[model samples]
Target: MNTFTETTNTASTWGLYEQMRPQEIEAIQEKTPIAYLPWGAIEYHGNHNPTGLDSIKAFNLCKDLAEKNGGLVFPVVNLAANLIKSYPGVNFPKHSIEFSENLIRLVCEEYLEQLVAQGFKIVVLLSGHAGEPHLTILKTVAEEFNNKYPDKRFWALAEFDILPNDLLVANHSAIGETSLQLFYAPETVDLETLPKDRLITLELDAVSGDDPRLATIALGEQIVTSFVKNGSIIIEELKQKYL
Candidate 1:
């Protein structure tokens, strides 16, 4: 029933760090000293969506933005500070590396330092995970980093904040996220996997928002378009001010 035109080749000229050549990297830095880092967490989204939903959505959005606006899309950091344990079906896998709030802060600080060192004057930190604590930690780190290095500008915020109030209805694995996944990475979602009968479980009732069954690819496209438009506006404003 979804009558949306999907681009066969979604790739773009966004110089993703790992895939970019030296000349391409130099070109972006020379043209616009702006960089973006999409942050997300590896956690449960529901039975329908993939566990890496947060990172996947964030990275894809950043890639699209960078391709249009001219910047470098750093590799997505899929590790988040903490997992919301209250939700059912959530898994906190043990990491060989330390995954703590302090570590997150340190990692962000060092990454920004390196970006500045590489001649990037402005850095955007966009997170797909909406955990209040996680967002707060990132905000605190960005503020501290800016204070220490006033020459470089850093802004950290959740991706949903870029959307208009009407299109900003977001939840953990509900319609918003589910629709995003359906649009951005359709292979990662299988609506048929969700339980048919509505049970009053934490995963279904408490964590998830309105019925994900109502999610549509059209809605996903609208959300993505809104994010790109608003994000581009913010990026242009920063460029005008910083560059």
Candidate 2:
């Protein structure tokens, strides 16, 4: 009876490891040996969305999935690789808080090692940060960890990778990401702050793709629903294979 509708209730306190009591965690562990680790970054997402948008989105999605499918939801890692060197309108001193690729890889490896040591057989790493370098590093770390720990399973993926191609169209603070923020973290987005006169360019702003002005909460909800449904299926499959 774990339907999509049942899982979309964001108010549910079933998935978050930080929110659950020790006994409750023990009970969940008895049922499933899978864990969800959400990784995000504190990078600029234009004027409308918060810097923590990536992490927030990933954390919420992981929570939704863990609620439907049995698993432990680890706290989101907010620091990620932000490859915004060439992008304009970037306030490096103020907003850009990033870790090196090697450091990130090491962190991921350690996290996996600890999770496996804690008795989790399968660890699903969902990165909210869409930077190619970040994703590549994560994938490499996951591969190396799996090689070292043959008994444990590690799966790393970016958030967009799980979505359909149509919904997959996203960019820095564009319609896709804006809509998602509107749906998941409404308070963090400020559409009013966006310039209304001229079209935002990569130099003027880090925004790309379709205008975010066209974004709507309805569209965001649809995307989230689809992502959760698809993600739940993937998690179930992983469980069957590894746990």
Candidate 3:
């Protein structure tokens, strides 16, 4: 595909005007004022994966979509919700995770409000972290935001929703997330440092749900391709319906 880099709000060349700083943005805004925002947390992924796995995944996805469509990626927001604390054997939360969910929801709500105030008519919330409460709160906030600000028309969409199960759940590293990173950001990975012991494998499965050692760049590319196609389709449909 042809990749063209346009100046975005986050880019040094463009200021707060964001997708509208350039003449193209003004023209497109009148036609399709769409923006994609990624939300993820800063917590442990596994011994093999980096702690910024969620943020990295989210940022890369936004970058891909933004490259195709005209939009800007907000800086990553790292707030742990479900994966609050860790134990020796388990990389996930060890205690009850209730308080953090509310905190995360409020923070997200504020950010969403700011985005709307800044003139983003169509916003998408793409999250990599599967923390149930954090995700749940995000959904609630999206609903409330749309209801309160009908003109803005904001929506929260999961990356997996735009991908097929074969792409989302068939590979290593929680199925698709690991593969995507492998394809897009290989330097973030270290296969030599990966644990190979049988005991370690079983222990990791008990906590993180999938085996990270099995992740590959090829699998990640498949997932990324599927996401780009489906995500663009959804964005186009929303644009036709709303914008």
Q: Highest TM-score among the candidates is held by which one? A: 2
Clashes of each: 0, 0, 1
Q: Which candidate's lDDT is highest? A: 2
C-alpha displacement of 82 in model 3, angstroms?
1.0
lDDT of 1: 0.75
Reference-based TM-score of each model: 0.86, 0.89, 0.78
List candidate 2 stretches off by more than 4 Å: 1-13, 85-93
User: In the order shown, what is each candidate's alpha-carbon RMSD?
Assistant: 4.2, 3.6, 5.3
List pairs with backbone clashes in candidate 1. none
The window of 10 residues in a row where model 1 has the poorest summed lDDT is: 1-10
Candidate 3 pairs with clashing backbones:
179-220
Superposition-based RMSD of candidate 1 using all C-alpha atoms, in angstroms? 4.2
Q: Model 3 — TM-score against the truth?
A: 0.78
- Report how far residue 145 has shifted in candidate 2, in Å: 2.3
